[model samples]
Target chain A: MFYAWPFATLLGRVLQPSSVVDTLTSPGIGRVIWFTCWQALVSTALTMAIGFAPAYVVARYRFRGRRAALAIITVPFMLPTVVVGAAFLALLPERWHGTAAAVVVAHVFFNVAVVVRLVGAMWAVLPTDLTAVARTLGASPARVLRHVVLPLLRPALYAAASVVFIFTFTSFGAVKLLGGPSHPTIEVEIARRATQLGDIDAAAVLSIAQLIVLAVVVWWSARWQRRSEHTFAAGRTTRRPRTRSERRVVAVVMATTVAAMVAPIAMMVARSFRTSSGWSLTPWRTLGANEVRPGISLGVDPLGSLAVSLRYAALATAISIVFGGLAALTIASARRHGRLLDTGLLLPLGTSAVTIGLGMLITFDTAPFDWRSAWWLPPIGHALVAIPFVVRSLLPTLRSISADQRLAAVTLGASPLRAWWEVEVRRLPGPLLSAAGFAAAISLGEFGATTFLTRSGRDSMPIAIDRLLGRAGAVPHAQAFALATMLFVLTAAVVAIADRQEVVDARRA
Target chain B: MLDVRDVSLSFGGPPVLQRAALQVPTGDVVALLGPSGAGKSSLLRVIAGLLVPDSGSVWLDGSDVTHVPPHQRRIGLMFQNEQLFPHLDVAANIGFGLRMQRTDRATIASTVEELLAVVGLHGFGPRRVTHLSGGEAKRVALARALAPRPAVLLLDEPLTGLDRELHDRLALDLAGILRATATTAVLVTHDHDEAATIADRTVVLGADMT
Candidate 1:
């Protein structure tokens, strides 16, 4: 209901067939669509290149520092795109700030985690014996990789690439902040047309096009993900690097990964601390009492923005848990229609956040149900967007548990409820906690949906940072950096707890 | 007495068990012997109330429990895979059923310790089930199944996966433990020697037997 009706209400404007033709024929429209696709394609390729070695290492070889490397890669992916754009805005050459290269670079930085986590999950359980068997049959190492490894990895690779493409395709906050006017994405264009130009006709057409593109990508990726889903063994052994050269390779790969992933974050934090005059904590100190006009009045401060974000994150997490948990259980229990139910529940995942926000604006404000101005609307949007991810992540773990486990508990004299608690819920602490972290973190960093819903004086951190950057002064820009750092720290802390819980789970095993 | 009568079940395919029947008096161990497709495990499942037969009545002591859920049946089962709870240590794993009964902490702890001793793993209480070796894991599973002191225990393929020496030793130890506790139980296995080692009466399940 959060997705389909509201989205359909907005897209139903497409009944004006003239608008579809006129919008497509409109000047600069083709450029927006072209930029969206091409940049996403390029960003997906770069992310794969940067993420492959780390994904492979995390999958095949076990080590102490790989956890740290994984953490570094993962944190960026969960970060809000606006903050990523802010980080590069702080780190890159000033001239590159509004260039196409800036958007691509930030996209790569933001999405390396997706490629790593998706591809790594599949690789960890991939049977190594097949490659060894090929070698025993006299296939060369390169040949083994080409024939045995790549073929096995294809499903995972396709799944990861398509996901990265969708994220980069729906690029909103980053493209808005970094893409500038010249390198506009369809999302930025829709935001501009609807909010700035009052061009709902054009915006509706663009939303339809984006929805079609995303539907195809989501469908394609789901197929590959299904093909890749066979790998969750009860447990599989991934060996620590044993030989001298192998150990060295692991060390080198880890060090480089950590350095590369951590640099932009370090730069952002350092920029937050320093100034034209010298290093100081003035920006942080002034965060609770800052103004857009510098000395005129106090305005969008980091403390208020942090509180706003935390509240939203907390609300979103709670909402997603109830809705997403029930959805997963419902899907898991459906004997014959589980796949169909899962696809239907995951409907919101196929639409970009901006589309949801825009749809809400279109659908909820007028006529029959005019509750668009409700305070719960934005958090609800975040929850709807997050629910699909929570369901997807929970289902595999839920399904991996055999019916025998629950029956084992039951025949041990546990009540059916007690059996479920003992076998199903107890085993799910890791996946559940991680999914919660994703919900909270995704809400904390969510910009596209929140941006459209932004109101002055109560701006979220992402909104505050975006507005602060639009101002022309050291203090405003410094405050933007300060808030971005706080956003990063908040997001990272949440994910760290979830990440460590995963390791703790393995330790128990 | 634990009695199964006219127990028939199929999982959407060829019949796994057809009108199978068995009876075990209190404190008597029965070993079910069958060929691979003769439904020895399926029969164990039916008796334990994990599976409801298409047509059957299960009697515990006197009353028919054909439609009773597994937990209400007061029956215990040690799975073929030794489905030990991976999250729990050896002690907690053994005490899970007692905890479900809302047994007091001290009694649960004492019972867990006693069962650990009975299984010949005196200090294994704190060790995670996942950390235990194969033979140790089997002992833990047995200890766990027996901890609740069910009216009857159903063990499926107790020593099937162990090496020959381990299998022989475990079978002997298993028989000793069953007799020591006077535990009423049904064990399913294909090996006739294992049946001879463990059961007072061996029941062969096949087309020729009921």
Candidate 2:
């Protein structure tokens, strides 16, 4: 409803049924979709291969520094795409740039965390009974995993694959930085046509096409989720003890995962602190220096942008928790499965943030609906991006509260609201706090669509870093590195807090 | 004090309890006995107002309370596991019902202490529920349920998971507590020995009830 007008009108004009049919038949569109499918498929497969062994180790064994290793593996998932791209750029040799191979490598780097976290968590909860039964049937470990474990893990694996596919399909920053002209995502094309060439019609048509593709993928994934005929007994899985060979395998996998995940970040940090002569603190010192270029300053300060980013992130987190928490509770309480409502809440996740920004820009930048000047647009944009995560984090915990407990409370003379508060709300603090922290981190690091939505002079940390990278100067580049380092530290802090809450919840359970 | 007349209930596929009727006078503990999947728990659920039977009437104190919501029925249910709120300490768990009823702080505190004494859990009020032993937790669960002075109490396999000695001791303790409160009670169990130990009258469930 918010973006109905411009989308309708623009669709009416540019996506004349005739042109859409033509674009559908065009070889370019097919090529683009084919490339997207191939990239996402390979990326998902590679992520699984690289992530599975380490995830299995973490799920099964108890060893020194295991918790720290898990935390390190998760850091890439929390970092913004642009920062990940920047880290890769800093690490890669100049000669090894602007190739499809580089883009694929970057996609794998960005998505391995998704596979590890989702699959590893699922593995942790697998019931020991299944494995015991298989062993009694005289099955080896390899045979059990192939026949029993993998079949049981289908839902999580499919979910992770769909998420990775959507992310890579709409990937903007990494491809833009690594592949340049050689590889352009539909997202990049939409941005180029809309902002650089002033072709709203073309941009609108492309955005609609992207939306259609995303809808189909999401719908397919949802169907797959419903059709997958596997449900494991809850709260029954136990960890296994590692043998010598198993221990060696676990050590090797952990070392590779950590090294792969951390090398780029290490390079980024090293770059943040280095100068031409040697290691120096010049970049950090110059982070706050305000040198105005000719006729460019519109009262925008770097420090002010930092404040704005924090303010917007805080607001977005609050909004996400309230709305997302309510939605989760409603879903949990519904007597029947709410497929439509669930899909509606999750649709924004697959739709590119830049596309959403464009949709908002087109709808709200003019007429009686004008809200471009309200200073609320950015936070609204950030909230849209964060709500899906909030729902994801809250749903599992909400669903885990047994129905019998709620009934027990009610039969004990508690009102409906009181019963819910005692039985449901009491268990929600950990997930809610963690969701809020994730939302704040997302808002802080958001760049792609934020670049399109904000005013020309106003900037967030990511946009500031992008500007510094674009300009041809030593100081600006150094400042960009410093700002990137600061953003990384901030994101790492937020994720650490969220992970701590998760640990606390695990202990309680 | 409580009467259930010709109750029939189904969960979409098949009826779990059909045309089942039972009665319990005040201060009587009626044990509902059945094997697994014989709808013993479902009967208890219906009595506690957690499930709405297809055709039935529940009378408490000569008033029809069939349509009353579970919260308004003044019934208490204790599961095999204690199901104590993990986030709350023993005192808060005991006072949970009073807090829900919006009772004053002084009354809540006094009732919690009184109930703790009855359960022989003095000075355990501030301890986390997670830290309690199996027997101690069951005692606390009983105290919490009885703190609100419910008109009826329901227990579902309360001794199913315990060893023989602990189970017998807890069963004896629970029966004594129920007698002292003069609360009409229903106890569901698969073990005939447990039912005989705790109940004043025993009713055996059959496939016809399901």
Candidate 3:
């Protein structure tokens, strides 16, 4: 409901039912879609192939430093795409930056974390005795995996595959930063049509098509997740690798999974400190200065952008928490009707980020609702996307507070509002803090939509990095890397603080 | 003969099984009687080659098979949890071992059909294993373990969770199946009556024994 006014109005204004066919069937549009499909397919296939071994190892093995290994694998996925793409650019040769291979490599790093977490958690609850039974029945280790483990894991695999496909298909920030003119995606096409070409008709048609495909993938993924979670009960404890070969396999897996993830991020942070003559922290020391290097005058200041990003993050965090908490309470209080609201709230997730960005840009710029110059406009857009995530992360904990607990308070000489305060308010700080931190982190690194909303003087950190990377010379690139590192650290610090707070609250509760 | 010699094992703490040894002559059944967590299941895994012990060797027919993989040992194990493949139907689950052995489809089908009847589920070949009752799942697990006709079979508390009437009925059926095939077997259980009913000899694995 938050974005419905803008989206419906913009669609009504720009999308003519008659011209939808003419625009969708236009020549060269097929190439945009073909590139989208093949790249998504290739990225999903590569992610699944590279991610399965590590996922299985993490799920089924008990070893020292397992949590640390998992955190290393997970950190890349948490960082903003602009940061991730900038890191890739620093790691790869400049000539390879815009090629399809670079795009696929970036997508792999971006989506691999999803595969590891999703499939690993699914495989954890699967009964290990099934594999043991198969072994005793004369099946070799490979045969047992082929016939038994694969079948059991099919649902989760499909779910993860579809999710990766959807995200890759409509991906904007990574594609915008990494994809050059030769490899254009449908998402980039929509952004171009809406912003640069003055062709709202074409943009509307493309976004609608993208929206349909995304909705379908989202629906299918939900079905697979339901089936996967429903089919099996948790059983059997995971054990440390007991044999020589088992321990060797675990060691090799650890080295590969952790090393593959940490290298690019480490290189990005380290490269920012290097100069033509020697290693210096000039970029780090001078990043906040209006003029970064002696000879260059880059208009966008990294320091100023940092302040802008923090302001927007604070506003977005406040908006999402208040609205998301109320939404979760409504959903929990009204179970039957809440299912519909639950699906509706998650619609923003299924919708393309490019489409949402365009919708906000257009709807506010027009006459009747011209809030385009307002300082909080971009944050409002950020909050629109952040609320769904907040609601999702907070729903389970909200539901865990049973109605009986509230009723028990009510029966003991407390009014209904007082009862809510006594029960939910007392237990809300942990989950609420985590949710707010998540919203803040998202706004800090949000690249896809922020790319569109950066026409204002105030630029977010991701936009600053993108503009810096686009400019030539070593200083600009160094500043981009420096800013990327700062963004990375800020996002990581927020996540770590939230995680620590939750653990502390968990112990207290 | 199936023999386990001085199998000692621990999980980085107190030993769960220490200096445990057992020998079963061909065509005879032995029961390892112990309470829960007495390491009877761990010892059975060691003999089946699913787990390697700290100090032990498993011998089958005068050949050391301790370091061999479980698939090559020809020792069938029916898990206490009856870990039936939820994805496979009854006949496919029963025929899994034969398929692994590369038996012809005709032979696999005949063996699966006959074994389903032996376990009193003759018409259950097409049914999903996930829908089976607890007792039925155990019967299918037993049938699947027996389908390849292992030289020796291991049952790990196979009837522990079933109700009294079903347990008694399944015990009789299990004993009849074992004797009729003349299968060399070892069964582990915490129930004294179950141990007496299913084996020719009973050995104790207690805390003090470990």
**Which candidate ranks first by DockQ, i.e. highest?**
3
- TM-score values for chain B across all models: 0.97, 0.95, 0.96
Please give the CA lDDT of all the candidate structures. Answer: 0.82, 0.77, 0.86
Full candidate order by lDDT, most accurate first:
3, 1, 2
Task: Quote the positional error of residue B57 for candidate 1 in Å.
Answer: 73
Q: Give me the overall lDDT of model 2.
A: 0.77
Lowest-lDDT window of 10 residues in candidate 1 chain B? Answer: B80-89
What digit string (tens of lDDT, one per residue) describes model 3 on residues B95-171? Answer: 99999999999999998889989999989999988889999999999999999889999999999889999999999
Clashes of 3: 0
DockQ for candidate 3, please give it: 0.73
lDDT of 1 by residue, B26-143 (tens): 9999988878988887787777665678888899999998877666677888877776654457897788777666689999999998999999999988987767788998999898
> Which pairs clash inside model 2?
A126-A237, A127-A237
lDDT of 1 by residue, A106-134 (tens): 99888888878988887787665434323
Model 3 chain A: ten consecutive residues of lowest lDDT: A228-237
Docking level for model 2: incorrect
* B101-180 per-residue lDDT for model 2 (tens digits): 66899999999999999888999999988788888988998887787778888888887777889989988888888888
Q: Model 2, A23: alpha-carbon shift in Å?
A: 5.3
What is every candidate's C-alpha DockQ against the true complex, given to 2 decimals?
A: 0.01, 0.01, 0.73
Interface RMSD of each candidate, angstroms, one decimal: 20.3, 19.3, 1.4
- TM-score, one value per model: 0.66, 0.64, 0.95
What lDDT does model 3 reach? 0.86
Docking quality level of the chain pair in candidate 1: incorrect
